[model samples]
Target: MRINILQHTPNEGPGSLLEWAQANGHQTFVYHPYHFGYLPTAEETDMLFILGGPMNPNTDLPWIKKERQLIQELLDKDAPMLGVCYGAQQIAKTLGCQISEAPAKEVGWAPVYRKSKIVPGLPEKLLVLHWHEDMFEIPKHADLLFSSNDVRNQGFIMNHRIVGLQFHLEPQADNVREMVVNDFPYIENSVLNQSAADILKTPVPEENKKTMFKILNYITGD
Candidate 1:
C-alpha cells in the first residue's frame, strides 16, 4: 500500500505508524507542510495519515484551508485515512463539524471507552496518551468509536474508511520525549494535565503499539 503522511511539525512525525507500515511492507511518503506549506495530490497516495500538531484549525491560515481541501479530495475518492489529535480536528472541520476548545486539557494517560460495537478489536476501556485541548463534534454519518469524560468524541470512524483519534496511540517512549521537549509549555499542572515526570513514567507504549496496529489494519482493510 502507498501511504502518505501529513506531518505538521518535526517532533510529531509518524511514530508507530511508520513502524507498522515498514513491518507490513507498505511504502510510506511524508509531507512536511510546516516547511513546504503544500501537500501533494491525493492520487499519489492510497492512504492518508494526518499527524497531530500544536496548530489550531479554526484560523485564517492559508495552509489550514489547503489541508482541508486535500482532505475533501481524498474523501471524495473514498481513500482510507486516519487523523490524530489536531489532524482529527482538521478532518472534523472538513466534514462540516466545528472544532471547540475542550473543557479541560487531557495531557496524560486517560481511559477511553468503546462507544460502539460496530468497530471491534479495541477494548472496552483503553488507557491511551492524551495531549490535545481541542475537540470536535462527531461528523454526520460517522460512528463514534471511543469517548472519555473530558472529550466525548474521542474517536470516530466515517464511512468505514476514515478514522479520527483524539488521543495519541502511536507515540513511543522516545516520541513522547521529543514531544515533551518541543511542546512542554502546554503542560500545566492542572487537574486535566499531567506533569512531565508522570507522563514519562506511564507504561503505555507497548500496549498502544499493539492497539495501533489493529486499528490501522482495520481501517486499511488489511
Candidate 2:
C-alpha cells in the first residue's frame, strides 16, 4: 500500500505511523504542503495520514486551504484517511463543521476516555499527548470516539474510513522531544499544560503505539 503523510511543520512528523508502515511492508511518503505547496492526489494515496501542526484550519492560509481541499477530494472517494490535531480540525472544517477555541489550551499528557465502542481495541481510558488550542465540532454523521475533560471532542470517525484524533498518539520519545523543543512556546503555565521538563521526562507508553497501530489497521481494513 502507498501511504502518504501530509506534514504541516518540521517538528511534527509521522512517528509510530511510519514505523507501522515500514513494519507492514508498505511504501510511505511524506509531503510538506506548507513548505512546497504540493500534495498527493487521491489516486496516488492508498491511505492518507495528516499529522499535527501549530496552524489552525480556520485561517485563510493558502496551504491550509489547499490541504483541506485535498482532504475533501479524498473524502469524496471514501478514501481511508486519519487526521491528527490541526489536521483533524482541517478535516472537520472540510466537512462543514465549526472550529472554535477550546475551553483551555491542553498540552502534554492527558487522559481521553472512549465514548463509543465503534472502534475496537481503544481502551475505556487512555493517556495521550495533546497540544492544541482550537477544537473541532464533531462532523455531521460522524460517531464520537473519545473525549477529554478539557475538550469534548477528542476523536471521531466518519464513513468507517475517516478518523480524526485531537491528540498525539503517533509520537515516540524522540518525536515528543522534537515537539517539546520546537513548539515549546505553545505550552504555557496552565492546569492542563505541562512544563518542558515534565513533557520530555515522561516516557512514551507502549500502549500508545499499540493503540495507534490498531487504529491504522482498522482504518486501512487490515
Q: lDDT (CA) for every model shown?
A: 0.87, 0.90
Writing each residue's lDDT as its tens digit, candidate 2 over 53-93 gives 88888789887888888888889888889999998998999
Best by TM-score: 2
Which runs in model 2 stand beyond 4 Å of their true positions? none
Candidate 1 stretches greater than 4 Å from native: none
Alpha-carbon RMSD of each model: 1.3, 1.0
- Residue 165, candidate 2: Cα error in Å is 0.4
TM-score of each: 0.96, 0.97
Per-structure clash totals for the candidates: 0, 0
